[model samples]
Target: MSLKGVELQIAIPKTFDAGKMADQHHQKTINQQLDANEALNREIERKQLAVNKSEGMDAISEEDENDASNNGQTSSEQNKKKKQQQEQDAQHPFKGNLFDFSG
Candidate 1:
């Protein structure tokens, strides 16, 4: 038997395009990353707004305390306390000269 004049033929199924699949996967990841970043930004903005509101409240409370203090004490008493504190500070010349964390 001679097969010199016969040629063999095989049909293969179509394969997926690896490059297209990779591109699609990359796009999905990028979108997910962008969504995460946006969510983080929103959270940060919310936290900053809360901090600002709290800071405003703190300032109001501090003002109230100042008004209360001013109303509660005489001006001479306040001046006397200030003089005493100044004298105490003068007595402590070596205060804050060294850092101690021995607690």
Candidate 2:
């Protein structure tokens, strides 16, 4: 017996596109990252505004304090003490001389 000719056929099912799935996942991650960055920027701007408003008030208070200190008697006794300390500091700015400073 001899099998001279035969017709054989094989079919393989198509596989899913792994690369397309990966691309979709990447796009989703990028969108999420962009949203996070925008939110962070908004928060930073809000914090800067708060800091500026507070610093402005602080500067005004310091200016008022400076004006109050021009006279001999200050608005608070603490200011008087600070003035006395400043005068003492002007006379002897450092407890030890520069030659005696280790650091």
Top-TM-score candidate index: 1
lDDT of 1 at 91: 83
Q: 89, model 2: CA deviation in Å? A: 13
Q: Cα RMSD (Å) between model 2 and the true structure?
A: 9.1
Please list all clashing residue pairs in model 2, or write none if there are none.
none
- Model 1, 1-103: lDDT tens per residue? 5334232222121124566678899999999999999999999998877744456787678757765778878889877876886687588667768867797
Error of 1 at 25 (Å): 0.6
Q: Compose the digit string of candidate 2's lDDT tens values, residues 7-103.
A: 2121111123566678899999999999999999999998877745456787679757867776666468667776886787588655556664477
- Please estimate how well model 2 matches the true structure, expressed as its whole-model Cα lDDT: 0.70
Who wins the lDDT comparison? 1
Q: After superposition, how far is residue 4 of candidate 1 from its true place, in Å?
A: 17
For each candidate in turn, the TM-score is: 0.43, 0.39
Off by over 4 Å in 2: 1-17, 52-82, 85-103
Return the TM-score for candidate 2, rounded to 2 decimals: 0.39
